[model samples]
Target: MSVRIAVIADDFTGGLFVASNLEKLGIPVFYVCDTAVLHEAADGEVLVIATRLRFMPPARAVAALDGLTTMLDEIGVEHIFYKYCSTFDSTDEGNIGPCGDLLIGKYGQRRLVFGPGYPDLHTYVHEGYMFYKDRLISESIKRSDPITPMNDPDMARVLQRQTAETVGLLPHRVLHRGVEFARGYVDDQQGKGVRYFLMDCVDNDDVATGATIFRHDHITTGADALAIELISQWTSEDAGTRRRTPSPVARAEGGEVVLVGSCSGVTLRQRDHFAQDNPMLDIDICEADEDILMARALAWADEKLGAGQPIGFSVAGDVASVADAQAKFGIMGAARKAEAILAGIAKGLGGRGVRKFVVSGGETSGAIVEALGIQSMQVLPFDELGAGSCISRDARRISLFLKPGKIGAEDVFSAALEKMRAP
Candidate 1:
């Protein structure tokens, strides 16, 4: 199969989310951690490269994409899609707009389309304002996020703060006119020198319609839902050749454990809701001493594992304590320490015969997968929260469910566990 789309995801979980969606549509996909492995797996119909540039500075994110375009060009991949979190997670000094700018510069395109709203996940953008399940992002729990606190709900305004070019809106009204009209409208916008567009999508159809208008060379942006739409269009040309076929479900044999390091309200609810029936361990970053915290957590986990109980680990504390830790150690410092602890616990538990894993937060999941020596994973279907199983590509072959943290429901953890254990 020829490579139809080359995706550059901002983080690991985001890459898996896109890859899972593509796989569901029967579009063969190969996901790589970095550019070095691109040569090892070049035969898949779609290539999703997971880059760690999302949390970096704009200059760094742009710099990271420097040699990437040349590689993509040589590979004969014409269409490039830049995927970020559906929640639009980034600071005013964005890795989104800056990274988008770099792609535009490399492709020499006068216009680019960008939107993070995934209606299936209750993320929507209308009239240039972002809404998380109808609540404006500024009024949502994301406002309290320690990393990229979404203070302004206006996406164009938010993106304008990051890019030098003017950000325009491609409202739902344009999409309602149909894909051809939308394509014409986009062309008109490009003629006006509008380089960046914040498109509105209320549902999958809206995204599909918007995606239908995209030329093979036009750069598009959004979450996995957008990619689903894009892939659907590309595959429809040969419907008989690329239809979904059922396969036997793979059931993992082991108890499950969940580790959460993301402080998003969505993850907080998932962790707390799943905690109702599961054993819980909370890591207090304010404990100040890493050795003592690690020792205590390992002891507690060993005890739970010995009894064969499903356990949970969370790195969240009370508001005041978290603030104090951030104030003392700085945000990056605190995050690194928390990830280290979680990675250590993951390695320890995996060594003790634990195979089933549910990891929340991108950084936390990345650290655990790396520590567990998981180079790649086979995506498995789960519930609508976009949670899916990833069997480790290595000989160890552990099962994992990597949640996007900002997506999923309060019962997402339990749902994922149920999926993992399903016969």
Candidate 2:
């Protein structure tokens, strides 16, 4: 049967992250990172596509959604979930708002629910305000994000700046009223021309309530928080039949590499933590020519892999200089060059018998997969790092640990390495 659920995510890591959540609940899920393989047939119940549009312009994001929705419709997907970061990562002139509006218009779904509160991830919503752990998102370090800084904690105000549609709220109080009451609240909001509702969810139960109430065909938007409940509701009755055993972990040949490109404070800490146990090399792309940088990176990778030692390749400098790179090579051009270099490094390492990789940073992972010619990958929950292990679709079946810089523990790299080394 055709997939009933299809998720359009804003980045590579987030797509696999959501798929891993559903997969663990016994839902067969196919995570497609490259759009070219969107039509690849699968026996799975869900298909998650990584659009990597969060970093793009608003118009581009909308256009991408248009194409993705059309493809999903052709593939007979009955339900749509537009997944973004649990932190509600986006700019005032958003990729989230515009893309969400496009999906609403395409599906003729009167109301779309927006909740980025994944309590497990410490993201919560209170009175329509977004919280990171215990602090309001605006009060967090994300306020100084290099690309799309989140300055507002109010979900309504945050989305209002991106679209002309009326933004409404599914208050925490209404959620506690149970399914029917919550469903009525949604209808009431729709009557007031609120096309988008930011639903408040403080815990798993609240999210389950929202999921139980919404129709399967209704278009929902959020991180994987709501997905946990939705998948459970869909398969609860047939749990025994739908469930599958966990796949066996495979032994990794050759050495591994953890590539760091993001400049988030969390990534900085992770880099320092991982470096304490592994050899870490810094690539100074800004100071050298592209050719020289590539050559040096390859030489370093060769030395590490040749010695059977796990190593890390980190880009030197912070994200504050992103504007400088953009000024030098235009916004999109800068992104392209960065991806190109990272992809080159991956290709060089992979050619030299490196079978496993830990690619951090959303854009970096996306680019690395594409450069390595991975059209599609089977996603498995990697660890408590909130990342995913991916096996390429090709015969090589290369193994990868894709982590979005901000996610994962201080010893995430160590955990990933151990898993990869596990037989």
Candidate 3:
């Protein structure tokens, strides 16, 4: 049987790289992030879920991530691969460096992966302008900006070395990839099983088209189709078995539900998706003013309480930024409002009733818990990186954290709610 797999991230390059290396290992895998796409791709087999972290603001990108966390927790994923957002700047991924220790300590039966991820699109373009003004590609990243990887050679070296370390630590090389070319130098290269790879639509296509086609705008839509094709090569034998169809309607009632919409420009649309099963309100706490979110949370609680309905909230949103290094610095901005909601629910409980909040979405999970002073709340645990610290109480509700990049299937979110319910 092929090695089943799933990959999550804001971008696509990382997935291709992972798949390329894994293909050599003779392991089959599937790379996915979108809900519709992932559901279409799953097979009933032991699976690995690889998720990438970006350095953008949490508010812009946490919703989808939370959705993924919920799905992974409910359905269960075997290996946890975390590729921290890469940076050309020195302080790209601060405390996140120790993610391996974090996941393994908390969640049982899982592996650890940490990527000194590549720079986001803007960071690459802007910094590239400074690095290679001689070629003159895009004007957006003007020469005024300092060059990265070029000017800061030390940062590049650190990232290169760490990228290798990230892939080298995996249990078996059967289904692993090295973003940095040199990481997958394994001894058992002439091994047994078939190593396949996962890929999103765009990146997969680009890799398929290789040097034969290189246009100016062509790279924009470049996808790594070979990754998907490789997966197809392996999954074709037993795709029917690994595939799963989630329940159409939520298994439980959506009461006192908390709504977190952090995705940009598409807040109401995303809210509608959630509202399909539950009475969801579009509350993008990340972009909305902190005070506004607090007021909204209070109001949401009050409305639910008046109806004698226990509130259970689901957090979702996008938190993308131009330069990840600059935006994630003071992450407290995203944490405060989420903290308020958790605290409000806690206070409303009066230490008695069934006070439970189903926290979904990556940014919502991380920030909300942090706001209530809960440090390392648990989400979809991979290993040490998954095990976070206590949510230090600032007189707030109990907080929970979820991993990034996933689909919020009905069953998965339902499971999280079940975990939060009073035992």
Candidate 4:
């Protein structure tokens, strides 16, 4: 079937999560990082274009999305979902707000609904503020994020700062009154020139309510929860049953490598938990030269891979160490250098016949995929490896488990290794 839904994910991991959620509902999804392979996605029910636009400047990110709408239009996409992080990760001069504006203009919609709620992940919008579990986002772990630290809980205020258009809130009170009242509220707000509505999605029911309210909207932007709800609503009974039988897991040969570039608390804990048994190399980006780092990491991997043991290399550190590195080499510079080193190590490992990769961090995953020259990867059925597991559609036959920094369990790394090796 031609693609009915198109999800423009701001980052790789978020896109993979959305695709995985759809797969759980038995909807076949084709996920591509490079738009050149859009033709390959015609058979899937949903087309998710994963972009590395999350960290780019607003102007550059907008420019990157310029022709994507046209491409989706040609493919018979009925709905467009702009997927972002559930934490609402963005700066005041956002890649989110500016990109949303661009999408609004492209879809010719006066108002678009924006909700960053994924209750399963303890991220949801209530009233106008975002909460991480029980605490507001300002007081949550996201406050210490190495990139785009969230210091505000009020999402409406946050979004308003990023866009020139008038931003408004769709309070939970209105939503609790049901869809009919909610739709009328949205229509009235849009009539008053509210270009974007920050929705209050505190639970699954709230997400379903938001889905019903914006069911006919040409474009809706939010985290994976909202997309999941919308996709579930759009899926017909027959289509949902078409792929209930899981595809046999693709077998992969050669060595395995785990690369962690995220400094999130969850990732750090996962790294520690995995290190208790498995071999891991901590990448020291602060003092080591890039060439020397690559040489050392490759040599280390060679020994581990030769011994038939899966190994991990990490640039993950505590907040103090991350701050120190950022101070030494500005934030973006430090991040770029670390990503470059990890990407180099991945390339070197791939050359040495390492085919299964368990990668952590969104930017890190993007870099490794780009370095490996992988254009498109099909999202595999939801497995124990959790959200972002996929097999490359290219000749390499590589299997990858791409985990977002904050979304996995303490044993996620070990779980990923086991899942990738399953027959």
Candidate 5:
């Protein structure tokens, strides 16, 4: 019944994604944002620590993991999973490779497994190159990402530029041979001093095979799919002893607000779709000052606050519009300005009794949550509500539906509101 698995996610939505995957296997998961509460997790529960380090400098990101290994050791955690986006969203100087190197050095492990694929989302890796459906990631919608535009689809080369260690790849052809051959290939690569290993997961079957080969490894890093497969394998080994009581249904009592800050193609489409029925206001980040924008947004929300239908405020726009904003106010400057304006509006809505929040985008979610002073929350099984929905356990009784920028359906906003209000 001791804690066996710990996952360090680089962003809020990624952490919730991993927790939701583990919940699929009925493994109890404690999702926390604050590192100080690591010891508070109950016995037998997996710990998923969500951090806002996705956009931080490599050194700062590595420094944030300073005492995490020691904390996990004290809590009897046997394995560590480093989770990032499926598209391998990182810059040339990364929070992925640098963070992975820190964990490797702390755990004294020779090779760190990297699988940045989630086949369900049409995001998978093959021959060390990442793809979205049939198109290479470099040519996909992710290339337009403002904060971390993925111009290179080669994950091995992408990760190599971030760390000083040698990187290797395990292709799908070798994995198609089976787990035994795949394991031998990985072993051979490690013998040649490859400190990092990226697995080619073109489908769910490849993910399952890779999970089987590394089920008992000291460390396994990837998106949610590999972790889900690994947990399924581990729990099946001793099903009777590993199961824990299911969490109660997560519900909250408050007004609802949908905040959109992602500029991804999917989110832009979702914003347009939701605008057909609900009331939505787009925050202009082009030329307005932060204070003026926040004031204008809050004033607009004052009229739409208690309209029964969920009111939405978005910074999402077409790729051309985003590019225009980036040209006006540098890339990061525009993003930070949008996040600050949204965070301010969230605070204003909270004061007006809006508690059920459906947030779109990773960086936007982090900004809003931190502004609300939320340190931790209990992870709930929200597959029914949507992909990544959960409720806060604090006094506010807030409900959060955190949708990754490029994730969720066109009707995701209305669907989450309907589910949140369902009796």
Candidate 6:
């Protein structure tokens, strides 16, 4: 039998996207976003699964994980890569005892590689934003964060490490890369195709994936010139196949366009009640399941005619915890939630006259693209992760997206309810 690789996680998009990347590298992929078959492993080389969605009480989550261990043993799953989760806001391991730091101690670290579960940040210079209009072309780069390939420490608090390390990793392609990538982003009527959100790292253990920016004076930019440059790169044959629908015929509408972002519905508290609406749903930061709620949210949107409204929305997901900054924002779970909501909404929006949607969140955008089930995508030179996009037929039903709770939690929601008439 072929060595089967199964990706289990709390969020669907992140797990699936990672699996897809690995698959392109010639790995067979299987996913268990559901808990029912977590232990049901196929014989494989390496298995990557996240623990946050296992959101039962610690004791309960462990029991369930214990059952998974037995299943893994029965299935002969040897190499396992489990995302060692920290406290929601703290980098310390709060509940690893029940989940077996022992087994993982014996096997996980060696078998698993830990880092940011989403896209690495590639900065885009949004022209004409006077706030950033100041000339920093003579900027001196500094070591802002800890070193990379370092020990697995909590990232939320690691400002120095996160910032300094990823500075150069961003695509310098702009200076020496593609021009077409920059064009078609926007027109005068439309806004810039994308924006740049930058930060200097405070602390992130090196060895974590790249693109973890720590701090910042300002974030994000929008400009029309960037769009023209982006669209110039859009050849009819190229973008047509990749588009979520036929590409919008008219000029671009930059930041004004609403995009989908995804995070767990419960984890992403939309209002001041914050953590109250579904306090019952809080799981160990490592143990929440997104499939169930994601399924329901899409269903609710459809039942509610959420697809019909001429609205701009983001389908955000996987808000693991508000406790910590690193885990809270740009984590894999967050990305997964973003992808799932988009998928659910996409399915719901099929043929419903829903046209275009834009994306802001990085990880969520990655999840959306991955969920589209395409082999190779038509991508531009910017931070493809954050590059503004309208996914086509795969998003035929509805467009969904997600972002961290900390970013634009209010302004980004896209759904509107239809008023009811009573006799």
Better of 3 and 6 by lDDT: 3
The candidate, 4 or 5, that scores higher on lDDT is 4
RMSD of each candidate? 2.6, 2.3, 14.6, 1.8, 2.0, 17.0
Which rank order by TM-score, best down to worst? Answer: 4, 5, 2, 1, 6, 3
Clashing pairs for model 4 are none
C-alpha lDDT of all candidate models, in order: 0.77, 0.78, 0.34, 0.86, 0.83, 0.30
lDDT of 2 by residue, 217-280 (tens): 5588888788667766765654333566557545557768888877688888888898997888
Per-model TM values vs. the true structure: 0.91, 0.93, 0.34, 0.96, 0.94, 0.35
Kindly indicate the candidate among 1 and 3 with the higher TM-score.
1
For candidate 2, what is the lDDT? 0.78
Indicate which candidate wins on TM-score. Answer: 4
lDDT of 5 by residue, 143-226 (tens): 777888889999999999988889999889989999999999989988999879888989998999998888888888888788
Error of 5 at 416 (Å): 0.2
Model 5, C-alpha of 390: deviation from truth (Å): 0.5
lDDT of 1 at 358: 89
Candidate 2: list runs displaced more than 4 Å.
Answer: 237-241, 319-336
* lDDT per residue (tens digit) for residues 59-148 in model 3: 333444555645655554432334332232223332232222333344532222222211212122121121222323223222222211
Instruction: State which candidate, 3 or 4, has the greater TM-score.
Output: 4
Pairs in steric clash, model 5: none
Per-residue C-alpha lDDT of model 6 across residues 1-423, encoded as one tens digit per residue = 222222333333333334333433343333443334444433442343433432344466556565655555556542233332111111222223333333334333211112221112221121211111122211211111100111222232232232211111122232122223322211111242111121111112121111112101011111112211112222122322122222222222111123344243322444212223211122222233556655554454455444333323444323223224235543434444545655554434433444343444334444444444322221111222322222222223223232332233342333211100001
